[model samples]
Target: MIKSMTGYGCGARDNHKVKYTVEIKSLNSKFLELTLRLPKAFSDKELTLRSECTRLIERGKVNITVTVEYVDQTAAAATINTELLKNYFRQLEAVANELGTNRGNLFELALNMPEVISHNEEEADEEEAALLLNAFQEAVAQLNEFRKDEGVVLKQDLSTRTQDILRLLTEVEAVETDRIPLIRDRISQYMDETVGKENVDMNRFEQELIFYIDKLDITEEKVRLRSHCNYFLQALDAADANGKKLGFISQEMGREINTLGSKANHAGIQQIVIRMKEELEKIKEQLLNVL
Candidate 1:
């Protein structure tokens, strides 16, 4: 079955120490393009996360955002520089003595100094990583489900459009029968009027008419176009990433339809060919989002 490249998914987990939220958004792209946002502590695991996303999403412009909120205040434990604080206080006291100014809030000012309070870098925890991975997997699963649902709609539209083109092809066949005879009669009447019926060479005229009709015959194009349409449907039914393949088939279908249009001298057949082209164009537009 075909899958659409556009989708959105989110998964979140909240616990005592931390809260993990994963959001994934995707849009149609020719290749798998990924943009990942991760916490600094999890920066080392970015490659693993990217690889996992690439494995699941073959083609799309994918954006993944991971939010890690620390619920426990102690998660980011801060240490005070006692020595620095005391040194600042002593310096401030000396300045106060020299200038005879009150050292009001001196302790608070010292505590607010740069580097006086610093957080210790926490080591990566395997358990927390596993939990985050679980959330990430859930988000991916949800995205796949979204893609599948969108794929069903695309499949239906594409299939219906293909059938419409086939119906137009049948209409072309209906009008095609009278086209050659009309051409022959028109040419014969013109020759009889200009060159006189007795002077015309019937044998030579028959040979030339046969050659002309053969050049304009759309039998091969119609057969090939039908085959291409069937192949497109088959690929859509099979389990694989056939977006590019479908595009190639659509191009082939376009070629046949154009050929039919050019060869169809009859006005009714050309109109039917135009309708076929319109349906094929719709299929191409929808294929852009298919994977």
Candidate 2:
């Protein structure tokens, strides 16, 4: 089944005093690219979170944002580092004495220095973190489900486009068969007119006609294009991410279609080639969103 690379999923859960919300957005890409925005407290889980997303999403350019709202007011308290402050105070007192200045408010000055007032946050509880992980998993699962549903729609649209191309191919093939004999007869008449009727060698003319017809023949191109169309359908049916593979196949199909256009010299065949190109272009545009 095919899945689109574009989708959105959001989830939220509250545990004790912390409320967590996870939002994920994905877009088409040649490789798996991930960008994450998370709270500073959860920075330790960055690698693990990215790994989990990689394992679950498979492929795409995915952006994940995690928002944490702490509901509790009792955050860690800030306190002066008494020992460090004392050391600073002692050094300052020595310098002040040499300079003949009073050591007034020296402790207060030392306390104002950075890292002096440490919050000494409590160690994060592993269980609470586990809850967060579980919530994240649920959110990812919901995201994948949304993508799957979107994929069903994409699959139907792409299949219809493929059928359109096949129909055009059939039309072109029919026109080529009818055009070949007429082209050969016209060539023969032109040759007979240029040379005297009796001087025109019928056997040699027939040989040249065969060679000319063969050069303009698109039978091989039609066959290869049809085969490519069939393979595209097969790839779409497989239960894997086949966006890149589908893109490659479409390129090959385009190659055959272009070759057919170049070889088709008949007005009818050229008209059909134009229609075939239109259909193929539509298919290629749609394939960009598939995975």
Choose the strongest candidate by TM-score.
1
Candidate 1 wrong stretches, greater than 4 Å: 77-123
**Worst ten-residue run, lDDT, model 2?**
119-128
Q: How many angstroms is residue 235 displaced in model 1 relative to the true structure, after the best TM-score fit?
A: 1.6
Candidate 1 local lDDT, 38-143, one digit each (tens):
8777888899998898788888999999987778878768799999999988888888889998788788888888878876333447777887898999999999
lDDT, each prediction: 0.88, 0.81
Per-candidate RMSD, Å: 3.7, 3.6
Q: How many backbone clashes are present in model 1?
A: 0
User: What is the lDDT, from 0 to 100, of the residue 172 in candidate 2?
Assistant: 87
Candidate 2 per-residue lDDT over residues 1-291, each given as its tens digit: 888878888877766766678888998876789999876667898899988887888788999988766667455446777888888889888999999987887878888877778752333567657766777887887888888898888888878878888998888867666778788778878877888669988889889889998898888998999999899988888887477898898899999989988888878777877888888788878777776
Best by lDDT: 1
Worst ten-residue run, lDDT, model 1?
118-127
Instruction: Score every model by TM-score.
Output: 0.86, 0.83
* Error in Å for residue 79 of model 1: 4.8
